[model samples]
Target: MTAIDTPNGMAEGTLDGSMAEFFKAQTRSSAPVMVNVRTLKRFPTAGCARLEATLIQDGVPTQQGSAIPFVIRYEINLCRDGRPPTEGIDLDAASRVLPR
Candidate 1:
């Protein structure tokens, strides 16, 4: 099982399996409607492996239009075996997707 280490605490299991705990700990208001999960890159060091991914969430809506879902952008990092310690796992950064 994959372990999700958040600033609040840690959750152990696959993403789907840990949905309840994740929402309780990380989100506010509504639950995530969609998660566009994609890996950006991978780094393998001596003792641990590092993974970078781009996550987009479609859940909370914009103030202007409630019907249109707000797209949230996030960059996440996952560390294996906790080697470096500097680079930890979980939601690293989050921001609203700007319009074009």
Candidate 2:
């Protein structure tokens, strides 16, 4: 139930997106052709967790379209007990990103 959107870590990039949301406690989220993200594990002293995901430009993009997939990584800082897995991500009118 991990939530994923944009590329987590990258320098000088842009998210041509409109709006989205994610839960802090949510993990193991996925998407069919959007992007794949998930949490590996947790630690006691860790206020932040690790998420691994991939973003791909699937075909569904043009009249006669072709696209390729991309790989991205995320190191998110989430508060414990903040947002549960079944909770709804409010997006705040945007998407959840993990770029550094």
Candidate 3:
């Protein structure tokens, strides 16, 4: 399996600001956190890359706002990586990625 690029035109296995935000939201809490990204493919796969948020608060990350904490909102986006040019990751939708 190949690495996927961020929704934006980033190199394969890279995350943009929006992607970081999505990860934070998924984990919940505006406080900053880090994300380790790997392809949801194959068996016993290797991790692709790890992304750190630009800022952190109380061990959680806050947006790199201008002298203020930014509200964690969905207006943010997640860069999707795939072997080929795929649509993107739908965090709101569940992926049938695991065996039932």
Candidate 4:
């Protein structure tokens, strides 16, 4: 599934033209971003899991300086009925900005 977290909100599944524009408008520059997994937990039910991670954007440009950095904390819920060859995995994600 295609999932992306934008500054305005989260965009999931097949993105449309408007969503693409929103992403471009929100993220004007191509800043290097990295996803760092903080925790992973599996549910009692098979093929179910949850992940918590942070998206780090380093060396962001700002009016005061050009080295500003920020982090966005997010959680992803994933589940699948069978293996990849036969089944598909579903993903749902949400995110929030962490205070600097």
Candidate 5:
């Protein structure tokens, strides 16, 4: 996976487990999250696609009387193969916090 514009800068290659850890820390104090898919483009590979989405943290107002929710924009390359029980999936993603 290749992560660009991450909090810690760009990272490349297999993510192993660090990606989970990164997001876990990022959302540690946020409300329940929801993903809104903005776009999807299939790749030439049988089970691969590019996805763009917004991660919205509901119920978290940005201001005293505002209705804006916290949001993060991200794009990812996703691939899956094999059957469910033994299927393998890979992700290459980049994310950044969007300005309110």
Candidate 6:
């Protein structure tokens, strides 16, 4: 799969501040967290880019025994104006994605 770039054009896969705030609100956590962006694609025809990111919350111990913690799939779209298509993730929305 093609790695996604952050809104700031960083290849490190970290989400922007506003998006991070949105995620935090959704997750209801003030704990330190890290979002691993899996892919980012732009479609000139659609005039937007689809972003896929994974949310990881810190200090949440799981019973998997040193395994990965809870990982939630988050999808967001950046319009031609470089703003989120919506206030937050909506499962009903069809995210415009490029084939990996």
Provide the TM-score for each candidate, comma-separated: 0.35, 0.31, 0.20, 0.45, 0.43, 0.42
Candidate 1 to truth, TM? 0.35
**Best candidate, lDDT-wise?**
6
**Candidate 1 local Cα displacement, residue 15, angstroms:** 7.2
For model 5, the run of ten residues with the poorest summed lDDT: 85-94
- Summing lDDT over every window of 10 consecutive residues in candidate 4, give the lowest-scoring window: 1-10
* Tens digit per residue, CA lDDT, model 3, 1-100: 1223443322323334886678567545455543233333322222332332233323333365334333331112223342322234463453566355
Worst lDDT run of 10 residues, candidate 1, spans 1-10
Runs with alpha carbons beyond 4 Å of true place in candidate 3: 1-16, 26-28, 37-81, 84-100
Cα RMSD to native, each candidate? 12.3, 14.1, 12.0, 12.7, 14.5, 9.7
Q: What TM-score quantifies how close candidate 3 is to the native fold? A: 0.20
- Candidates ranked by TM-score: 4, 5, 6, 1, 2, 3
lDDT of 6 by residue, 17-76 (tens): 887677656655555566665446665534456777676765444455443345677776
Off by over 4 Å in 6: 1-31, 45-47, 61-68, 84-100
Task: Report residue 15 deviation for candidate 2 (angstroms).
Answer: 11
Q: Alpha carbon lDDT of residue 35, candidate 5?
A: 49
lDDT of 2 by residue, 1-100 (tens): 2232223422232223332123211211222334555554443443334445444332223234543333445554343455433224566533456333
- Residue-wise lDDT of candidate 5 within 1-100, one digit each (tens)? 1222233323333222555346535655334455455325555665555556566654544446554566788776655442222123332221234333
lDDT tens digits, residues 3-87, model 4?
2122323232322365444543454534545545532555555555455656555555667755567566777665554322212
> Whole-model Cα lDDT per candidate?
0.39, 0.37, 0.37, 0.46, 0.46, 0.55
**If candidate 6 were superposed on the true structure by all CA atoms, what would the RMSD be?**
9.7
Model 6 whole-model lDDT (C-alpha atoms): 0.55
| Candidate 1 lDDT score relative to the true structure | 0.39
